[model samples]
Target: MSRRPDPTRRSEQSRQAIVSAAVDLCVEIGYAATTIEAIAARAGVGKQTIYRWWPSKAAVLLEHMTRVRETQIGFPDTGDLRVDLLAQTSAVQGLFASDTGAVWRGLLIAALSDDVAADGVRTLLQAAVVEAKGRLATAQKTGELRADVDLDMVVEIIYGPLYHAWLLTGRPLPEAYMEEVLSSVFDGLRP
Candidate 1:
């Protein structure tokens, strides 16, 4: 008899499909409109399959964001702190430029309106901030960043404008804007 396929690999594939469906549906129809039934239909999986793995649609979207961070926005440790930071920041900016960014913003807005989504957003942001801090710590260790720089402050400086332009105002996230923001934050303009 033929051996059965690996259950772990099969489960992983199903999970990935669900996440992809959630991201796509959330982007196309806003988070508030994207229901578990729709995601399951889009993913070609049963509702029970999704509910069996995730507690809610928000949880699936949260896991989807985590997957996006892992696969799309991996931090690069180039040994040159400035280049590393620029690359990392640019990755974030690029994410905002992609379809996934639309879904992320939609979920964020929906999260603000709903407590469950808000909790998921909180967990997602906290984890992302921790990752950002870890990368900044590498810069500090390499002596590329000023010893006095507060890592949290640096994170805010880097993320603040991007969030404002992309999330708050819904403006186009141009690469030039990212470069200018990074230069302003890193180099500062003073006569």
Candidate 2:
């Protein structure tokens, strides 16, 4: 007889599949168009499977964002704060330059108009900020970042222009743009 499968592992795998499917669906079809039914279908699970785990499509999207941050955005400590900061920021910039980035931006804009989506977006951004601060803390300890520099403020300085250019101004985000932002940021933060 075949061995019995582990229920806990099976459940975890299903959950992951659901989240991954949700992310892919949200990226391909805008978040507004990605339904729980579609995510369940893509994951090869039933709609009840998803409904049992998440309250709504927004919840699934929020969970997917958390997973992306955990898996895709690994921050490195290269001893050189500038290199580390650049790498970290560049990783984020690359994400924004990707197809999923366009979807994420659209979702964010839609969130602004939908209260449920807005709450999910706010929670996702808060989690991202926390992760970013943890990475910045490494630089602070290395004495590369000024002790007085506010991590939150620095994060805004690094990301604000990119968002403005991509979302508000419809400008292209060339690598040179990121390099310039890094140069200006490091110049102001260097002790």
Candidate 3:
């Protein structure tokens, strides 16, 4: 006889489905046009099921973005600061070029007026920055970076342009652009 599926496991599967549906709908239809009823129908669950776990449609979108960013964003150490930064910046470029990028932009738009969405974006981005800062601190300790360099400022110098390009300038973040950004930042960061 086949073993019965665990209720907790089933519940988790349903939760993942809902989050996935929310992200897709948010990207395909834009966040404002998406609704709890539509999310339920897309996820093959009832509207009450979504309400049981999340307070609102925005909450579901926030949770979905949290899951995506946690798994996809990271700063890796490759011994050389330039190499490490290149890899990190390249990953950022790739993320902004993917469908998730559209969802992220949608979240940013939602954040302009919604406190919950704004808080969620702020918290999620802060976590990513914290991880990158740790890598910068390690480089400083190793003498790879200037001892007096401000980690927060360095991070902003590196990532601030990427966000600006994505949101304000609408310029392409290609490999050549990543190289130039890292080069300019490293020129001052070198000990």
Candidate 4:
């Protein structure tokens, strides 16, 4: 007799298949066109299987992005605030220049219309903000930034314009612009 397949392994396979299908469909059809039905058909899974594992297509696509792309930002601690900000912005610039950025653009567009998708996007961004906040606090402690500097405001000041360009203007986040951003933001924060 053939050995029984492990239920856990089977479940994981199904989960991955669903995620992969969701991403592929989103990429091929655009986020607005990709549906749970299409993802199920593409993944060779039943509708219930996807509904059981994810609340919505947005949720699945959110997981897909997290698993399929390296969206995590590692804030460098070069001791110089300008250096660290440049590295962080450079990484953001590189991400926006890649295929993953196309997916992100789709996701953001979907989020604008879908509240569930908006929440998912907010959650992902909030997690990154939490991580970046720690680094900013460290910089403040080290006297690189003024003790009175508001870390939250500092983060927004540093990254908000890049996101604005990414989301609205559809412009590239170039190194020169990143340097200009840092120079402007840091000018106010000097200890």
Candidate 5:
């Protein structure tokens, strides 16, 4: 008989497919409409398979966010705080402008009522904050930022506008949006 396929690899493939289907469904139909059955059908696996991997649709979407963070989103360090922040923030802006953004939006909405999802989202956000703070501390040491500047407030100041425009007003802006925000942060608003 021919050699058997690796069950571990096959299981991993199925898991990825389920996560991708969940994200796509959320983008197409919103979180309220994305269900285990739809995800199972789209993934070409049994509903049992999806349930075997995730307790709920929100958990599945959280996996997508986790993968995005691990594989794509990471703060870069070039010893230049401005350049690194621009690079990282640009990547986040890109995510908020794509299908991935829809999935993230759905998860945020779901987190409002799901304690598990809320905890998961909080964990993901905290990890990013810690990472950002670490980079900012280095910049502070290098005199890129004032020693008295509050790192926590600085992180909010950098990212707050993007979230407001994207989530609150639901507006679509151009590439220069984050650049302007960074400029305002770096140069201040008063003329």
Candidate 6:
């Protein structure tokens, strides 16, 4: 006689399928068109299965993004602020160009009209910002950055152009894009 299969393991598999289907749908179609029914169909599960775990598609996507952050997107500390900043920004640039980036862009648009999504997006973005500020605060404490400056503005100054170029201008980014931005920020804009 055989024992019963673990229901929790099967549930975890369903959850992963739902998440993967949502990510693919968001990337293939836009977020507005990717509905819970579609995700259920693509995932080979019922809408109730998804709703059991997440209230909406946005929540499903948010879980995937959170996993990526916790497992993959840690800000590094190599004892050099500049090196760490470059590494952090470059990783972001890479994310913004990948499949995960597509889902993230979709989430941003979804957040505009969705109260639930807006809160989740804010949480995800703020977590990243807080991680960045921790590093920046360390730099300030060690005297690498000025004591009289706001780390918030410092983060904006460092990332503003990258977001502008990627999300607005649609310009092509070279592999050394973050390196150039770091050089300009640290070495001054004027030659």
- Say which candidate scores most in TM-score: 6
**Whole-model Cα lDDT of every candidate shown, in order:** 0.81, 0.79, 0.87, 0.82, 0.89, 0.89
For TM-score, candidate 1 versus 4, the one ahead is 4
Question: What is candidate 2's TM-score against the reference?
Answer: 0.79
Give the lowest summed-lDDT range of ten residues in model 2.
Answer: 98-107
Better of 4 and 5 by TM-score: 5
**Alpha-carbon deviation at 44 in model 4, angstroms:** 2.0
Worst 10 residues of 1 by lDDT: 182-191
Q: Once all C-alphas are superposed, what RMSD does model 3 give against the true structure?
A: 1.9
Q: Quantify how close model 2 is to the true structure by its C-alpha RMSD in Å.
A: 2.9
Segments of candidate 1 deviating more than 4 angstroms? 1-13, 113-116, 188-191
TM-score of 3: 0.90
**Number of clashing pairs per prediction, in order:** 0, 0, 0, 0, 0, 0
Model 1 score (lDDT): 0.81
Question: TM-score for every candidate vs. truth?
Answer: 0.84, 0.79, 0.90, 0.86, 0.94, 0.95
Name the weakest run of 10 consecutive residues (lDDT summed) in model 6: 182-191
lDDT of 6 by residue, 1-191 (tens): 99999999999999999999999999899788999999999999999999999999999999989998898787898988889988889988999888998888888888999987899999998999999999988877887877767778888889998988888877778889999888888753211
> Which segments of candidate 5 are over 4 A away from where they belong?
188-191
- As a whole number from 0 to 100, the lDDT of residue 79 in candidate 1 is 79
Ranking by TM-score: 6, 5, 3, 4, 1, 2
lDDT of 4 by residue, 1-191 (tens): 89998999999999999988987877778777888899999999999999998899888888866754344457788787789888887787777766666667777888888887899888878877887888888888998888998888988998888888887897665668888888777878889
User: 65-127 in candidate 5: lDDT tens per residue?
Assistant: 998999889999999888899999999999999899998888888789998789889988999
Candidate 3 Cα misplacement greater than 4 A, ranges = 1-5
